[model samples]
Target chain A: MVLPSFSNPGAGPADAVVAASPTAPLDAFLDNQPQTFYESIYRSEAACLCILRLLPPVCRQIVLHVLWSHQTLKSADLKAFCGMDERLAPDAAEEVIRPARDRHIFLSLNHKGNKFQWPLSDTFKRGLRNALTGLGTSNSFGAPYARGPRDEVPTAEALTDYGEDTWESILKYMVSSGLTNGYRGGRPRNSVLLLLYQSGLMADPYDRSGHNPKLEALTITSKGFQFLLEDRQTQLWQILMYYLAGKQARGENAADILSLFFSLGCMQLGQDYSASESFPHMENVLDDLEQYGFVYRTEMGRERGQFFPTHLSTTLCSGESGASRSQSADDKRFLILETNYKIYAYTSNDLEIAILNLFVNIRIRYPNLVVGRLDRRHVKAAMDKGIAAGQIISYLNSHAHPQMYNHPPPILHPSVTDQLHLWDKERNRLGAQESVMFEFFSRELFDETRDEAERNAGLHLALPAKKLLFVDPNVREAIKDFIKDKQVQLRGGI
Target chain B: MSYHDPYQVKASNGTLITCDSAAKQILIHLDAQRDGPQKFIIRDVDDTHVLIKSIYVDMVRTSLQEELEKNTYDQDPAL
Candidate 1:
C-alpha cells in the first residue's frame, strides 16, 4: 500500500499547514503500511508505549480507559468515559473508536458467536499501566538499584547534558556526510547507522541496495533532511521503531527488548537502576543504546552495574510541552536569517552547519557562527535531492533566532522564505510527466477529443492551433476505442 | 515551530498569478480589489531579457483569466 501523505485529508488551513510539514511520528505511523507498523508495534513493549505517547491526548485517553481489561470492549462501552448520553448515536461512539482502530492500536477480536469488538493490546496494556501507575510488579518499569551512597549517582542536569551531547554527536555524525571532509569523530554505533539505512533516512549513493562501512558510502536521503529537524522524541521513536523491527526480523525477542526500553523511559531520570532489574533483555541492547545517549552506565566493569536513564529516555513518554504554554517558548534560537539572504547561525554545531549547508550556500565560518546565503542553486540542490522547499522553510521558521521572532509571524525574513519556495517551484517548471500524445487528427475531431478529455480530467496539454492534444495514459485506451468506433461509422456511412 | 507564511497575508486583496511558458515567464500582480495600483512582469525564463511596467487591474485580470481558461496557468493565484 502507498504511504498516505503527511497532510490530513480535510484539515483546515492552519492544520493543513502543520500537516504539510513533516516530523509527526503518529502521522509517520499512519503514512506507513499498516501491516508493517502493526507488526513493529506489537513486536515490542516499548513500541507500544511509544504509540501511546505519540497519540494525541484524547486518543491516549481512549487507550487508557480500555487498557486494563482483556475482554472485547464495545465502542459503546466508551460512552461512559465520554459522557455521551443516550442522545448520542451508537455510530458516534464507533466514530470515536475509529482513529485507534485505523491505527490498529485497538485490534478487532473475533469472539466465538459474538459481534466483533476492539480488544485492548495486551503488551501495550501491561507496559502502559506499569509506566503510568508505577505500581506493576513487572520489570517493565526498570529495576531499582540496591541502596547505595546517593552521592555517587549522577544528577538530572548531568544526564540531560549527556543526552544532549550524545544526541548532537549522532546528528553531527549524520551531518558530516554532507560535508566535503566527512565528520571525523568516532561514528555512531553500527546498529544506529544500520537503522538509518533501513529507515530510508540515509542511503549509500553508489550502492542503493546495501551499505558497506569501509567505503563510508551513505548520503542522507530526503527523508533524512526532515528527520534531522524532528524533535528528539519523534526522532527517538522513529529510530527505535526501525531498530525493533530489524531485531525482530533477525529472530531476536524484540518485543521484550522494546518493553525493557519502555521501562527505562518510565524510570526516574538520574535514579540508579541495577542492570539485573531489566535483566537479560537490556543486557545486549543497552550498550548499543549508550551510543544514542538514551541511558548512561556507571562502573561498566562490574556485574551489577548501575544505569541511569537520561533526559532523552525520561522525556520519551511525556514531552515537556505538557505545561500551559503547550507550544514552544522561544528558549531555543539556533538560526538567524537576515533581511538580506545571509543566514548567521549562532553555534558551530557541526551537525547544524552540515544541515544548513544542504540548502543554504555557506560563505564564511567562525568559531561560534557560520554565515550562509540561501540562493537558487542551494535551494535547487536540496529540492533535487528530494527535500522540499516547505520543509526547509519550516525548519528555519521553527529554529529562528529569538530576536527574529515577531509574535504574529516568526522572525525569518519574508524574502528568504518566498525565494526558497520560488526556487523550489522552479524545479517543477518542467518536471517529466508521462502522457499519451494525440496528433494528426482533423481540427473538428481534435476539438471533440480535447473537450471530452478535459471534462474527464484526463487532458494534460492541448495545442488547439496544431490540432494536437496530450492526455493521461490511463484514458488513452478509451480515446482509441472511440476513434476506432468513429472510423467504423465513417466507413459504414460512406 | 511557528511559521511565517510569506505568500498568505491578512485582508490583502492583492492576487499574484504567475504563468510559465517555454520561452518566457509572466507574473501579474493585481491589487484592484484592495484599491492599489497593479503591475505585471514578463521575463525570459532563460534570463535573456526583462520587461517590467505598471498595468491596469482590468488588463492583468483579463490576461490572467485568459491564461487560466486555457489551463496553461496550473498554479492557483496566490493571495
Candidate 2:
C-alpha cells in the first residue's frame, strides 16, 4: 500500500524510475500488534485532520526535511530542523510524524541512547519527491494542451469560481437531501461520488435516505465530518488524489492520467494545452476534472484549439500547500472581525458568506463586503455543527483581516479568541482521559515499564494513573510500548 | 492565460528561457546533455544563487515553460 509516486507502474524518465526493493514487508511490522486497549489516538481520521489543520507548515516541514534523511533524528537535531526549542522538539515531531506513520507516509526508527534516527519511508519518500518534483512520465502534474483547439481554455477566475461552485454544489446537494433540512440543489460529478464511495465516504449509496441516489445528491457521513475538518487546501488534494488513486485501482493506465494531472499544475492558466497529445482516454477525464475546478477549457473562434489549467491546475506543481505562496494574494482574505465583535468580510460570495455564516451572523450584505458580528447565538449555532473553537480560531488566523495584520500581535484579537473558546467550553468540555495499570509486581519493573512506554510512544507521563504501578495511558504510549516489548521479546532480548 | 507558442521563440545563445518579454524572468535550465558533467550558470534577478542540478536541465526548461505559459494564459483573457 505504499503509494509509489510514479503514478504509473514502470514508466517515466530513467532517473525518475525508482524500483521498489520490497526489502521489509509491512506484515512483519504488524504481525505482533497489540489489541485496541493500546492503540494510538492520533491514528483516527478526526485527530489527523485536526493536527494537520492546526499545524500545516509543520507537517510539510517535517516531511520535507526528512524525506531522504535518517531513520530517526536526535531530539536536538529534530529541534534544529524546525528551529524550535528543546521542549517542543520531541512532541512536535511526534505529532507530525505519527500521523504520517499511521498513514504509512513514513516509518519510525527506534531511539538509540539520547538520539532518534528518523528516516523517510522508502516508498513514501519516493512518492513525495515525485509529487514535489515532477520526476516521471506519469507527470501527475498535467499535460500540455492540444495545439489545435481554439475553444476550451478557461480563465483563471472561471476556474476558481467553477471549483468553488462545483464544490459548493456538492455541499449543497448533500445538505438539501433532507439530511440537513433540505438546503438546496447543487450536484458534483459522478466521479466525485465514486471517489467518496471509494474513500469510504459514501458507503452503500443505495440507502433509504437516497443519499447518493443520483450520485450527486449525497449525505455527509462521518467521513464527511472528517473531511470538513481538514483545511480547504487538503480537502482539494484529498479529492484529487482520491480520483488519481481510484483510476489506478480501476485498471486505467494511471501514468498518463497522473502525468497529465501534474502537467495541469505546470500548465499556463489561459493558454491552450494541446489535447491531441493526451492519452485517448484522457479526453473524457478532462470534462470530469473541469467539474471539480481542476481545469477549465474554452473554445476559441472555432479553428485554433486547446484548453488551459485554471489556478487549480497550475498550483498542482506548486505543491498541495495550495497558494499559501500567494499569502499576499489580496483575494485570498475573507473575515475581518474587530474587538467590538464587528465582522467585515470583503466578499459576499455565497461560499465566503456561508463560511463566515458558520461563526458569525451576517447583519446584511454590502456590495463588496458582508458586515456581521460573532454573536453568542451564532457561535453556539456553529458549535452544534461541530466547528470547534480551535478550528474557528485557526481559520480566522489564516484569513485574518488585512487591517488586523498591522496590529501588535497581528493574528487576531485575544478577546475574540478567548470568547470563541468560552463559546466552545460552553457547549463541549474536554478533560484528558487515560487508563490506569494497577498493581505491578515490583517498583523497578513499574518504573522501567512506564519509562519504556513513554519512550516508545514519544509521549510522557500526563499524570501517574491512580493506583497503577506503571501508568501508561496515552494511546500512543501504550501501543508503542506494546509493539516495542513484543519485538524485543521476539528477538530474545534480556 | 494565453501561452506563447514555444516554437515562436528562438533559443539564442545565453538567452534566458523566459517568457516573450525582457521583464519576464528567465528560468534557468542546467543542460546535462553536454559531455561529462554539464556546466551552467544562472542568477536570480536579485542575484541570489539558484541551484540548478546538471542532470535535470531539459526537464526544468520544459516544465518551466509549461508553468510560465499556464500562468501567463491564466492572466490573459483572450486565450
Candidate with maximal lDDT? 1
Model 1: per-residue Cα lDDT over A1-494, one tens digit each:
12223332223233244344222543553555444446654444455666676566777777876687666676456677777784565556667767666667776644445343567656556656655665555565566778555536678888887888888887877777766687667677677778787878878878844746333566677777667766455677678777777787889865466556656666787787777665554577877777788888766424565678887777666633322111234434667887777788887656677778888888789998888777666677778777776677667876788777564563665667666656655554422334565653455566767788887788766667655566676787787776556555544564
True lDDT of residue A360, candidate 1: 81
Reference-based lDDT, residue A431, model 2: 17
Q: Which residue pairs collide in model 1, if any?
A: A43-A255, A46-A258, A404-A411
Using DockQ as the measure, which candidate wins? 1
User: Native contacts recovered by candidate 2, as a share?
Assistant: 0.00
Residue range with the least summed lDDT across 10 consecutive positions in model 2 chain A? A15-24
Please, what are the lDDT tens digits per residue for candidate 2 over residues A360-450?
7778788888888887777777676556666666667656667778778847777787777656653422112122323333344445555
RMSD over all Cα atoms, model 1: 13.3
Root-mean-square deviation of each candidate, in angstroms? 13.3, 28.6
Q: Candidate 2, after superposition: displacement of residue B46 in Å? A: 64
Local distance difference test values of all predictions, in order: 0.61, 0.50
